[model samples]
Target: MARFRLLADEHQARSPLRQLWREFARQHSAVAGLALFSAFFVLAIIAPLLTPHAPYLQNDNLLLLPPSWSELGLVQYPFGTDDLGRDMFSRFLVGTRYTFGIAVITVLGALIAGLLLGTLAGMSRGVKSSVFNHILDLALTIPSLLLAIIIVAILGPGLLNTIWAIMLALLPQFVHGVRNAIAEQLNQDYVIAYRLDGANNLQVFRRIILPNIWERLTVTATMALSTAILDIAALGFLGLGAQAPTAEWGAIIADSLDLIYVAPIGVALPGLLIFLAVLSVNLVGDGLRTAVKKRREN
Candidate 1:
């Protein structure tokens, strides 16, 4: 009887997650986006094996070779070679790692910092909360990209610095979202019950508040991820990011401007990847929001 009851309890526990997956799967656009993003992730993981040549290796003889299918192209260079004769396809594959990796890292960093600050503000009152709220407002007043650029300029440009800049720029939104969510949750019946039951502030926050607000946080984090990607690309485009031979999508596009006419594929491929990545993340975020809403309604 005990084993049977345990099995039944486990099934019940699994039901909600299964329902959430069903809800997500019902969104065709979200599924498609997931597929696209998964493909890119796979490519990034297998890039070393897939790349035809070292991304930064320059072959003077193959300079500006168009894609293999192009009438003007060499069969050896599939997506073509850049002006410097580095393999476009190779650089692109490797770039998936840098571009997506940085975006994920930046978003996670911002989310952690924001969650801490927001939690503190939400749990406090009067002066402390006011200070946090005002700081968040001040941060929000600056345009995200411009704020990132300013930070990058001050920190000096590099992949790490760019990630930090973007993370800092994104922090305010997460903080604001979390703070509002926690403040609202604190007023809820469940939170009040927990408090009345002699739960400590930390206990109430951990067992009641965090779970209640996690769905909103998940949606916000996904949206923030897309913004981080775009910001990283923008920083790279402006010459304040990933640097030469680094194989970042925006940096590749920046370098290809002069070769636009000579080899349009060089410029278009990376831009297309960036577009697809951002679009995929946004689609996923929308799907998550819809699914969570439906879950709540049920």
Candidate 2:
């Protein structure tokens, strides 16, 4: 059976995607995390239909209502009502859009910008590379949230500004990682051999470098996504991100601070969602990193 399994693995190794999937599937926690993340993503998409009431609708009578399962709760409000009498469940559903949505947009923007800048830095020489590395190092020295705060301070508070701030804050890591990855690949014998074999820069990059470094890129992206989510929420909490009527998770938590004693669950639920989303993304990243390492070793 071991011999057969080895033969099967060898066959799968011919296809990197299949081998990656097989390795990733072996991680139960990662699979669970992927499922959880997918659920949140889907909910964010369908939140408008799933919400029991208008997320912004307010009723003084329902203010601070407990969860449906609680004694003082109503069946109509599963997650209860906020201090403003808006349905907590509805706000949560809508909030998912802001949290995940903004994170996705920020990460993608950073990834694209990084790929372009990192490629240029990696392919350049002397002064260009030095300048790029120095800039990245300077940015890295500042904490992401602090960098975002500085940016938001300049741009003024709002969801759009927060997105730009977080994207800018997250850009350096991707740029540095991609630059290092490409530089490392360029130093390898395979790249040198390809160049000698009449391959142009574009051909070598498309055929050899990208394939070799994609797993690392995937891991970095997953991790960055969680970071973006946290950063967005943090900015929102500080009043430098999504503002009132936005239903963003962090803003929701901020609004609930005054009513924490009366409606502790309001804060707890959004906080829990953020925790879960970050945990899920981290788990996926860990699993991908492990799979990539194992694949390389074998």
Candidate 1 clashing pairs, residues 3+ apart or interchain: none
Q: Judge candidate 1 at residue 74 and give its lDDT.
A: 74
Tens-digit lDDT track of model 1 for 104-138: 88889999999998899889999877977898899
> Which 10-residue window in model 2 sums to the lowest lDDT?
10-19
User: What are the TM-scores, per candidate, against the unseen true structure?
Assistant: 0.94, 0.95
The C-alpha stretches of model 1 lying farther than 4 A from their native spots are 1-14
Q: What is the lDDT of residue 75 in candidate 2?
A: 96
What CA RMSD would candidate 2 show?
Answer: 2.3
Per residue, candidate 2 scores C-alpha lDDT tens digits across 1-298 of 9999999887877787887888889999999999988888897788899888999999999888999999999999998998889999999999999998789889999998988888888878998789879988999999899999999999999999999999999999999999999999999998999999999988988899888888888899999999999999998888899999899999999999889999998789899999999998998899899888887776
lDDT of each: 0.89, 0.91
- Candidate 2 lands at a TM-score of 0.95
